[model samples]
Each structure stands twice: as structure tokens, then as C-alpha cells.
Target: MQGKALPGFRDFYPEELALRNHIFAVWRSVARRYGFEEYDGPPLEPLEIYTQKSGEEIVEQLYAFEDKGGRKVALRPEMTPTLARMVGERAQALKKPIRWFAIPQLFRYERQQRGRLREHFQLNMDVIGEAGPAADAEVMAAALDIMRAFGLGPAEVRLRISDRRVVVAKLRHSHHVAADELVPVLAALDKWERAPADSERLLTDALRADRARVRPVLEFMSGLRDGAAELRESAAAEPLNECVQRLGAMGLGPFVEVDFTIVRGLAYYTGIVFELFDQGRSLRAICGGGRYDDLIKAIAGVDLPCVGFGMGDVVLGELLKDRAKQPEAPAQLDAFLVAVSGEDVEPVLKLAHELRDQGVAVEYGLRHAAIRKQLELAAARGAPRAVIVGPDERAASEVVVRDLNAGTEEKVPVARLLNGFFR
Candidate 1:
């Protein structure tokens, strides 16, 4: 009987692993370019770490249970909680505006979808202890640069920027929606903009305010969609505005879009929020994060203003495939060694190891085999060249190097063959 991976889990065969590695390479490269030092924490942590920020209800969504030691623990579903505690512990010694990034394989007990999965590697890039708007722009620029690294451009993806304070201010001044109803109202707006036909009734009911201060404000809020679509009046929008300008100066203006509706579903975001969405907006958010000023203090018990974003490999991979920007297929062996005679096996083995030691990916059969069969195996292994060692060539301290792709052959002396075959 064959066992299978659980639903929503992945089995990364060679080809799939190639794509995964490509994603990781780009993630690390771009993150390093932004001056973000890589950091990581244990995958399993005390359950209270998450509970401190999200409360007990979050346990239901986590793979949380009691350990054999009778300690409550859970697989980490996100990196922020751990980041908070780690940074909090070193808050004094660490310099301000700390830049760190982590690529963690996170887990959650949730239904799987096109972009959402139970297990996936996420690139979490955050700037901590930085309250200025430039930090916001820096993180956003990092996210966009990752997309650009993979050949995606302005036409393929869009950055929807919003400030939670601006949204609340506009809603309070116009819709008269109470603080108690803010979550639902903002959620409804988020849905209404995406799935208007479905959320029409909910949004209509949400906007139906009996207070006299509501109608005009509701009208104004609704008109925002058609207006300049900029919140120039709010004080909180100033930093957001500065962030946008910084991105513009960095030549990323085309990818930016201001939509006040992006009141990120999370309650922790205190200021600017942004989500990267595909131009079509068909899948889930490609990436999302915002300025969470007090989240560190709340969870880690140390105050640190942080801004960051998490981009999962699953959706980003899918997006890359859709755009035909995925990396080329994994490379094959650099060379295959074939010994023409039983006596030649000794030379073949010796040279194979030397090539391998020199960092060339060379493969050879373990048992005796005919030269034709060896060449066949070399082709099967996708080696573009075969180093053929025969008694005649070995006697002369030379080997026949066959260029399989070009169907050409050359005899190079054994002295130079070790380092010169690949050359």
C-alpha cells in the first residue's frame, strides 16, 4: 500500500522542488538587497505566544494541542508573534529601525484554496523600531522588487495602499457607523468592492443609518470612489502620502494605487495598510501588511513600531506560472563518466571523483556496463557530455571527451582532463 500526503500538503518532486528553490533564491536575493538580515525561530512554540495577540479563539485555527510534557503548544502559523518576543528580548541592545526577514514554513488548520494552503513557505520581511514613513516605503519597495525580480511588472500586479485611520475617519464623518459596527462595515466594504453583487445587500443595510448625520456622510463616502480618491485632509494620511512619494522617487509609481478600502482584516494594524493584488484580482492577496505600532508592545511586552508583509510561495508560484515567468527546468548533470573496458573502470572511478571534488556534477554507473549502455544511461541522466575512458586512451594517459549535444569527440591528456574536461 502507498501512503499519500494529506490534503492541502505538497510533495515536492524534483521538478516542483526546482520551482520552490527558485522562489527561495529570489526571496533571499531581494531581501538581502534591501539590507534585511535573515532570522528565524522555532516552528513550535508555546501556544500562549499566539494567544497573547489573537486571543483564545485563534487556537481553533492553529494546530494547537498539548505536548507530551503537558505543556500547551502549537505550530507557528505566522512569524510576527515570535518576532515580537525575540525583538522584545533584545530591544535595548538592538539599534533602531531593525531590518530582518525570515522564510518559514508555516502551518494552519484551515480549508485549502487556490492560494491558501495548510502548509506553505512564507517570506516575512519586516522593519522594526522604525516609525517613520520611509520605513514603510522601504518595505513596500522590497515587496515590489521581489515581484520585479520574477519578471512581473506594473501591468501584472498592483499595490493597493490604505491607511486604517483614514478609513475610520472617513467612515465616522460620513456613515455615522459606530465603533462597534466598524469591523463589519469595513469588512463589508472590502467585500462590496470585490464581490459587489454578493455584498450589495450587506453594504446597503450597513449604510442604512437612521441618524440625521448619516445621509450626507454616506453620500460623501460613496462619492469617494469617483472623486480624486486621495485622503489629503487626514493627518494620518501624511505619512502614507510620504511613503507613496518615496516609492515614486524610487521609480515604482506605476505600481501604486490608493484605495481606502484596504482596511486589512487584522485588528492589529494601527496605521497604513497595503495589499499586493494581481491586476485581475482573481486570487487572494499576493502579499499584505501594514504599520502595527503597538502590536510588539502588546505581545512581546515591548513597544516597537513595525511594518512588514508576508508573501507565500504557493500563490506567488501560481502567479508566476500564469505569467510564464517561472524559472527554467532544473539543470541536469554536468557530465557522465563512461568506462569502455573493465580495466578502464579504475581510471573512470578515479577521474569521476576528481571531477566531483572539483565541483562538477558528474555521475557514473556503480556496476560494470557496456560502453553503449553507459552512453544510454548518460543521456537518460540528461548529461550533455560523456567522459569516455578506454584502455587505448588510458594507456596514452588521455580520455575521449564526447560532447553529447554536439555529437563531437576530442581526446584530451589525462594530465589536463581532470581540470580541463569541463573547460
Candidate 2:
């Protein structure tokens, strides 16, 4: 049998798992602070749930197969479809503006690259049942706060935000792109920055118009990336402007920018799309999402509006390491109990149990060992203190407490030691 993790998966050792836990802690803390409750669905869901929301072509990226029950299923690649289904099942019974978040391990059968794996854990935060810019601002705030919790600020990360309505309006009125051809044009625009010539060809083909018409559209799109397109006063840009204003009022203005180039490339995104990127742009997007007003209706026959984002751990962890924000693993033990002689072993065990019961992280050798050997083990485990129960100290109802780091020692009464002294 092969003795390694699958190409795009990971094996989180203690240190790696600690980092993962730290990321998750920050995610939960910020979500709760924003009054967003955590929720999760089955890791494996009906395949149609995804195809229904994103079309049949998405099957190319799914970990899908037929099960023994003769039903088609797939490991979830994203959380939005499941969120819509869960919300729709009891939409009327739930309160307005449902706030929910989830940390799910998502799978996708795709090529791996820097900051991208076939499988990864992602934090998904969504606001449902609200259709206004307030919901949009709320979701964006939560995402930004999580980045802040990780010792990141606007200078380290940037939020590029846009509104599909604004982009569509520009295409219709200025570029003369027809409604029937919007989808392909949007897809081509998504590729514009990465492959300008190819994207231009795609745009030319999708528009089926004169080559002359495509140049104006390309120039307009270029201006959006170069900080030359100024559409803030346009009516279609109102919702995005309001969202940016809300973020600004909350003092998150420095982290945000009105970049029309960020269309999110998702067909379901109807308005206010945003992506979080490292300021250096050294990796893939750390997060991306937007409002999908008709997605719930399309997937579950419910007309609730929703906004959310998915932040993956792969790119996020890479960014943290690059920015020197990775966290250290917590100490394994608070104290190590040592027995000086055979006679003191029982006292050492008793004191170890008492300290542990009092909420101290205590550890000791499972069997008898020399005092020096036990202290060495304690040091290896990064225990800060070692409690030595010697014959004389045990007789005097005391123990010698040694600070491993400072190399200091003191005699403490057993009674004082048991009463939450170590903690």
C-alpha cells in the first residue's frame, strides 16, 4: 500500500494541527462576535444539489460517484448550496436575516498549485433572508475582522469589492453588450487579467460583433484595473457605494477598494462581489463571495436573498507564514511530577492527581525512573516547572518546585501546592 497522503490532502501532525486550530478559533470568535451562529450539513450531499445551483458543468470538479444504494452523491465542494437547502426547508419558521457560518472540509478534483489543494478546510459565512446593502456590509465586516484577528491589517491584506449590477450596466449602456451574451462575456472578463489576448478573443467571439466594438469594451475593462474607471456616481454603483460607506464608517475603509475587475466569476453572484487578497498578491485569493439573491429560489424554491464568502485555510495559512503571523503551539504541560526515590513515588503520583484535578496540566513518568531522567523527560515536553517529591520533603509535607526555564528552586507546602497554586 502507498504510505503517503493523497496528492492534494494533508496529514496534520501536532504542530500543524495546532496552527489549524488557531485559525479555526479566530474564525469562530469573530463569527460569534458578529452574532453569526455556526451550522453544518452532511459532508456528502446529493449531487443534484450542486448541479441544480451551478449547472451540470460543475460535475467536472466534484468528487462524485454512485453509492451502493444506487444513488448519485458527491463530497461537498462548497457550502452555499447546502446552506440554501437548509434555510429553505423551514424558511418561514426562521427569523429574518439568518446569520450562519461553517467550517467545512471541502473536496474538489482539480489540479493542485501553490495555495490550492484538491481538498481543504474553508470558513463559510453567510447572511440569508436579507436583501439589502446592510447584509452585504455585515458579511464583509465579519471577513475583515477574522483577518484582523490573525495579526493582519489593511497593509497586509486588501479587500477588492465590486457589484455585478454596476459591471452589467457598464456593459449594456457603454459597451453595448446584449443581455443574451452577458454570461460568456463575464466569464471572459474573469480571465482578462490572467490572459489578456485569450480573454480578448473570448470577448470578441462571445459578442459576435465587429472587432472594433471589442476594443472599446477591452479598454473600458482595462480602465477598471488601472484605477481610471470612475463610476461611483452611476445609479448602478449605488449598492456597492453604500456597502463601501458602511465598511468605512466601521473604520475598515483602509482595507477596502472599489475594484470593478472583481466580478467573482460565479453565475449566481447577483451583486456586491468581493475578494480578500494579500497585499503582495503572492498567492491565490484568501476568500471570495457575494450576494446571490436568486440562488435560494433556484435550488430550494425559496426566494430568500443571501450574501457570504468562503475563506480557505490553504491560502490563508500560506499567507500567514509569509507574513510571519503563524502561531506557536501551546505548551504541552504546566508541571512535571518527579519522584526522588522509591519511597516517594506514591507521594509523587498522589500529588500529580491532585494538581491535575485542580485544573493543572500535570504529567509524570508512567513507571519508576531516576529523578534526573524524569526531569529530562519533563524538559523535553516543555513543562515549565518540575515538582520533586523527595523522602525528606515528603516527610516534611512539602515538595521542591523547580522552574525549568529559570533554573530556580523553592520548597512549597503540599497543602499550598494542592490549592490551585500551580495554575
Candidate 3:
């Protein structure tokens, strides 16, 4: 039997890897442009990191077990807990408002889906030691900038913004819901758009009330989905207002939409929360994140306000393909060296290494082969040009350069070819 990649996993062939690398390049470029330095941690960590942040329920979705040394560990499902632990270790000595980002391959044990997977790579951008709306706006702007870098625009993607504070305020004041019931209500609200019936049933169960009593709360939440402008009347919207205003000042207003329903479904999001979606709403969130002021303290006993977002490659790759944004695989070689006869093989080897030393991606036949066969290999490898070395040309201190795509050939001085003339 032929072995296969596990379900919900992928095999990144050269072409697919090219697209993944393209996404990663854009992510790193935009993150660095925003002054966020790249960082990484071990892919495997203590199992408690996931369990502590999300509780024991998360263990069911983690690839976890006891190690040979009797230590419980798991492949990290998310990067935030790792970030918190790292930052917390150096909190006092590190400079304020730390800006950091990581590209990690995360693993999860879950059902396979179009966007969701058991294993995937994610771009995690984070800001630590800052608590204000400016930090919120900063991360959001960085995310939008990445989309722009990928040829996505407001017309193609929408940044759905919200704040946990605002949602809690509306739930408590307007509907008089108790603080104790907020968790269950939020769990329902997180799934409200995808499964309204389930959401309502959960909400009703949480409130311990009949459908009639839950109707007003449902209506209130429905109105919030209208847009951000609807929430301005509440003082709880202050932080979100400033964040949106900051985005507006940066000319990113068109990509931003306020919605009170984006509570992020997590208990730790203490402040602003948000998710990015394709304007078509055909896939899961392209990215999602929020402020969690207490996570560092919980994980590492260091209190530092933080805001961040995780943009996974799986869904983003799907979106890019849908929108025709995937980049072509880069040409594998600048030139291929061809030996016309046994005597020319030595010079072909020498010239190949020389061109490579000059920073050109040059390849040549590793073993003796026919000149025609060599040219065929060059074309297959996507080499732009082929440098043909023959006894006559070698004697003249020159070689024939054949353009694979144009099917044109020209004689070039050996010195010129070695000096990056082709490059």
C-alpha cells in the first residue's frame, strides 16, 4: 500500500510549497515593516500550556502524551501561550511594548475541513506590554497591510472589529444578564452566525429562560450585526471607537467594520477582539485575535497587556487561490551548463560553480550525457538560458548561451558569463 499524508494534513509538493512560501514571505515582510521582529519557540511544549489557557477541554484536541522522561507535552496548537511564556520570562528586563511575530507549524486533533486542518502553519503577530487602543489599531493595521501586500483589498476582505467589553456591557445592562451566565452566552454568540438555532438554544439554556425572554437579547445582537456605527451610543464602545478612529486616520476605514458579536469565544479576551473575513463570507476567518491582559500573568506570573492575531496559511491559501492571487513557482535556475563532448565536461563543471559563486542559480548534468539531453533537462528545470560549452568555443574562451524560452542562442565571452552578465 502506498503511504499517504494523514487526513486533515497536506503534502506540500514543489508547486504547493511555492505558494506557501509566497504567503510566508508576505507575512514576514509586512510584519517587519511594522517593526515587529521575528521570533520562534519550540514546537513541542508542556501540555499544561494549552490546558492552562483553555482548560482541560482543549486536551481532547491536542496531540499530547507523556515523554520518555515522564513529562507531559503537546505539539503547540496556538502560539499565544508560548509567546506569553517567553515574554513573561523577560518581562522586567525587556523594553516596553514588545513587538514580535512568529511563523509556527501548529498541530491539532480535529475533523478535516476546507479551512480547518489537523496540522498547518500560522503567522502570529503580537504586541506585548501595551494595553491601549493604539496597540489594537497597530496590530489590526499590520494585518490589513499584509492582505494588501497579497493583492487583497477592502473590496475582497473585511476586518470585522469588536470588543469583549462592549458585548459584556450590552448583555448585562440592556438584557440584565448576570455575570455568571456571560461565559455560556458568549460561547453561543461565537457560533451565532454559523448556527443560529444552536446559538439560540444555548443562549436560552444559559439564561435559564424561555424563548420569549431570549427574544429581546437575540434582537439586540442581531442589530449589532448591522455595523459598527450602531454601538456608538454605549459608553462601553469607547475603546473600540478609538481603535476604529485610529484605523480611519490611517486610511484603513473601509476595511474596518464594528460588530459586537465578535466576542472571540475565549474567556481571556479582556478588551478589544476582532476577526478578518473574506467579503464573500464563504470561508472561516482569515485571522482572529484580541487583547488578553491577564494571559501572561496566568501563564508566567507576569502581568503584561498584549494584543495579537493568528493568520493561518490553509484558509488564506484557499482564499488566494479563489481570488487568483497565488504566485508562480520561481524559476529553478538562471542558467544550465551543457557539455558538448567529454573534453568540455571539466569546463562545464568549472563554469557551473563559477556562475554559482557569482550568485547565479546555475545547474548542470551531474553525469555524462548527450548535449541534446542536457538541454532538455535545463528546460524541464525552468532554467532561463543554457550555456553550451564545446571544444571550439572553449578554445576561443567563449560559450554559446541559449535562451530556453525565446529559443535564441548567442556567443558570450567566458569572463563575461562568470561576471554575472546573465544575471
TM-score of each: 0.93, 0.96, 0.94
What candidate 2 gets wrong by more than 4 Å, as runs, is 227-229
On TM-score, the stronger of 1 and 2 is 2
The C-alpha RMSD in Å for every predicted model, in order, reads 2.2, 1.5, 1.9
For model 3, the superposed segments whose C-alpha errors exceed 4 Å read 210-212, 367-370
- Tell me how many residue pairs clash in candidate 2: 0
Any runs in candidate 1 off by more than 4 Å, and if so which?
Answer: 197-222, 228-230, 330-332, 420-423
TM-score of 3: 0.94
C-alpha lDDT of residue 190 in model 3: 81
Per-residue alpha-carbon lDDT of candidate 3 for residues 291-321, written as tens digits (9 for 90 to 100): 8888899999998999999999999999999
lDDT of 1 at 8: 84
Candidate 2, residues 228-328, lDDT tens digits: the string is 24777789888888899999999999999888877675667899999999997988999999998998898889999999999999999999888889987
Candidate 1 residue 340 Cα shift, in angstroms, is: 1.7
lDDT of each: 0.85, 0.89, 0.90
